[model samples]
Target chain A: MLAFIIRRLAQSVLVMLFVALIAFIVFRYVGDPITAMVGVETRLEDQEIMRERLGLNDPVIVQFLRFIGNAMRGEFGISYRLQQPVTELILSRLPATLELAFASATIALVFGLVLGVYTALRPRSFGSAIIMAASLVGVSLPTFLIGIALIYIFAVELGWFPSFGRGQVVDLGSWRTGLLTESGIRSIILPAITLSLFQLTLIMRLVRAEMLEVLRTEYIRFAKARGLTQRAINFGHALKNTLVPVITITGLQLGSVIAFAIVTETVFQWPGVGSLFIVSVQVVDVPVMAAYLMFIALVFVLINLIVDILYYVVDPRLRVDGGGAGK
Target chain B: MTEPLLSVRNLAVEFPTRHGILTAVQDISFDIMPGEVLGMVGESGAGKSMTGAAIIGLIEPPGRIARGEIWLRDQRIDNLPPEKMRKIRGRHIGMIFQDPLTSLNPLYRISDQLIETIRTHLPVSRDEARKRAVKLLDDVGIPDASRRIDDYPHQFSGGMRQRVVIALALCAGPELVIADEPTTALDVSVQAQIIEVMKELCAEHGAAIMLVTHDMGVIAEAADRVAVMYAGRLAEIGPVRDVIKDARHPYSQGLMGAIPRLGESLERLVHIPGSMPRLNAVPPGCPFNPRCPKVFDKCRTHRPATSEIEPGRRAACWLYPGVTEA
Candidate 1:
């Protein structure tokens, strides 16, 4: 297991390096960061001085190598627009984004599992049909549209939740944001629901499909023949078997959730890395943009690594050393 | 005579498809007395397995018991609510399927599966159930049962897994076990071993068994009485020796003749002329009429009801209409 984890970590590092290189090339070609920073009216000589100072005057390969060397030491160059270290800028927004991601994930997982299992158990019922139709709407409709609709219903008309922005956040020492606070939680409710809508439906559909398949398996019939209660057979035998695939999809979806959060954050004006990413992109802040790309890529790789480890933990078939011994 | 442990009265299982309702098992009836092993032998798709499934209350959906009744010791079980039926399943009657690999849950240990079954039906604590599970494994001929109890289903060989499945079926000490082609998926060499284990264990537990298979040899060795099904109906049912030696139904005769015998240099094995009919297009009268050599005008127009051919023996054929005495 240790060897497997170490091997995965090595692969993750290689993946991150590849992502960094791609981001560097893509950002460089997209636009001139110097022009975006200084505006169109800046003098040509002033732009030249600014370019030379930021190492844009160096060869592409030399500039990339220099960026790599600095990145290796945890030094992402200062953001041209913000005049702060790119790492510091991302770090400052990390807690807010983390809180949002965690909240949305919890909501998605809890509701998805419950609804998925319920619908699967009573597949022919009217309630299941209604839930399935709702989930389809959740999957098909755009997240931004859902965010706006939520704001209109709960914030604008109902006056239940704040329409925009993170309500007053309390810094609970060492970069932790206390979501336990009433304002912090209430502020995030609309955004979190908006962010997780798609993922919740995806998870629900995946779990339902998997459960239906597993419930038909011969072992489940055997479990039924064993006179296990309906609850025991559905939850204990059928649900456990469904989880391996569900967990795999859930992990992959989590990465997409973080990636897609940019839209929800923009709609709600939540001060998170996603909003920072949008701001940095508009100004062409190459350092912050590249670092953001690399960070998200690293997150994806790490999430995949964790999923692999989880597979080993959940499925004994994968844990056995030499294959073909067990069926 | 003592009341039969299980009684099926004109059971008919039907499946509703896009075309119409197709009958899988049509008006079939049988009885299993306590401690008796009744072997149900038939060609593939002849509804032998469906009979067992219906008896166990596990006929898959889109298919259901369309007619008649199933009684377990006077309790009418054919139309019981699912919850009530579930309580009787592993407690009063256990089921073993063809593939041992698919019968046991791969994620669970053999002991856990066995103990769970035992505890579900019996008022035993976990520790007590665990002990009984280990003993069941030992009884089913697993070596070092106590140690192997913790092993998952995949860890065992195909034959060993079938044995574990048999042990699982017997865990709750059920009075009747519906073993649907239990040894069909096993190797020929190990088939006898499994049959031996099942017969010995069933005898010890005094459990009635409905052993469904197509193998005549297995029926000869393990069954006291044999039921011959042909195309969704019972063609013949009698003592194993009677059915094997003097089959009254022409279909059973053809089945017995098809079995290759030992030390007899026959020119060739007998082959039945036609295959069993599909459910969608089964003949209006007797299902076996098209395949039987002796099929006549009456056979093509009227379905034969099961009638006594001799003492303790019955067959569904027009030829035996007047044979009331043994």
Candidate 2:
């Protein structure tokens, strides 16, 4: 088991290295950092001095090594647009994006699993048919459009929620969160729903398909014949079998929820890193962009690693070689 | 006369497809006496397994028991609601499915699967269920049952896994167990061992077994009575020895002859010529008529209903004067 975990950790390191390389390449070539860093009034010689001071003249490998070294120390220089250390900038915005991502992901997972299993167990029922048809909207509509429509309905016409921004936030140490406040909770409802819609549908459909498939398996029939209750057969035996693939898909979707928070963040004007990355993009703030890329990659790699571990925990077949084969 | 532990009266299973309703098992009736292993033998599509499924009420949708009555003793189970029938299944009529590799849930430990089923049907504590499960496993010939109980299904080989499956079926000590092709997916060497373990354990538990298989050897060894089905209809049913040695129905005779005898050598094994008819394409009369070597004019025009040919034997064949014309 330890060896398995170590092997997975090694694979994650390689993935992160590749992502780091991509982030470095994107930062290096996308725009002139010096132009963005200085004003139009600055002299060319002064600009050269600043560029030299920043080690811009160094070879690609050296600069890349320097970037990797700095990244390891949790440094990403300064965001040119915000005039703040990129790490600190991201850290400040981290709480918002993380909260939204987690909220939406929780919504997506809980509702998706329940609805998926329900639809699978009662595929012919009227409620299942309606739920299935409604899920198509989630699959078809773009995130931005969903967010906009939600705002128009709940914020503009209904006057039930604020149209944009995190309403009010409380500080828990350095972390700022709207979760504890009423207005803040209300404010998150629209964006979170919009962010969750696409993933929820994907998860629901995948789970329903998987559940249906599992229910038809010989084990399920055997379970039924064993006189297990409908609840035990469906949830205990059938649902547990469906979760291996579901966990893999849900993990990937979770990474995407954070990465794609940009659209929902922009539409709702939520004070999250996605919006920060966008503003940095317009101004060519390479440090923040590179940091954002690295952060997203880290989330994905971490999630993949966690999912791999979960596979070992959930499925005994995978663990037999590592743990049971010895016995 | 001993009361039948299970009785089926005019059971007909049908599948409704786009074209028409196809009868999978038609006019099937039989009785399983208490603690007796009744082997159901047939070809791949002969509806042997379908009969087993119908008794347990596990028939898949669009296909159902269109007309039938299944009685567990005198309980009249066929007409029972699904919930009531479910209660009877594990506690009264347990089932062991084909493919032991797939019958046990791969995600669960053998203990969890066993204990869960035990507690579901029997009033027992977790620890009590665990103890019973281990004992049942040991009875089924799984070595080191207590230690191995915690291991998942994949830890065991095919034969060991089947022993676990047998243990699972008899865990709640049900009166009857429907074993559907239990050894078909196993190694040829392991087949006899599985059958032996199943029969012995079921005997110890006093559980009657409805063994469904096409293997006549298994029936001869383990079954007390044998019922031969041909194309969704019963061709013959009698004591295992009588059916194997002096089969009354032509199809059963052909089936018994097809088995190569140990001492006698032949150029080719006696094989029935035509395949069992598809459910939709079954002819108007006796399902076995076209393939029967003794096909006659009456057989082409009329179906033969199951009727007593001997004091304790039955055959559905036109040649048997006692068989009522359908």
DockQ numbers for every candidate?
Answer: 0.56, 0.71
Q: Residue B26, candidate 2: how far off, in angstroms? A: 1.0
lDDT score, candidate 1, position B12 = 91
User: Where is model 2 more than 4 Å wrong at Cα?
Assistant: A321-327
Q: What lDDT tens digits, residue by residue, belong to model 2 across residues B1-326?
A: 98999999999999999999989999999999999999999999899999999999988988899897999987999878989999998899989888999999999989999999999888899999999998888888888888899888888899999999988888888999999999999999999999998898888788899999999999999999999998898888999999998999998998898998899989887788978889899987888888888998888889999999988899998887788986
List fnat, each candidate.
Answer: 0.65, 0.79
How do the predictions measure up, each by TM-score?
0.95, 0.98
Q: Identify the leading candidate in terms of lDDT.
A: 2
Native-to-model Cα distance after best TM-score fit, residue B177 in candidate 1, in Å: 0.9
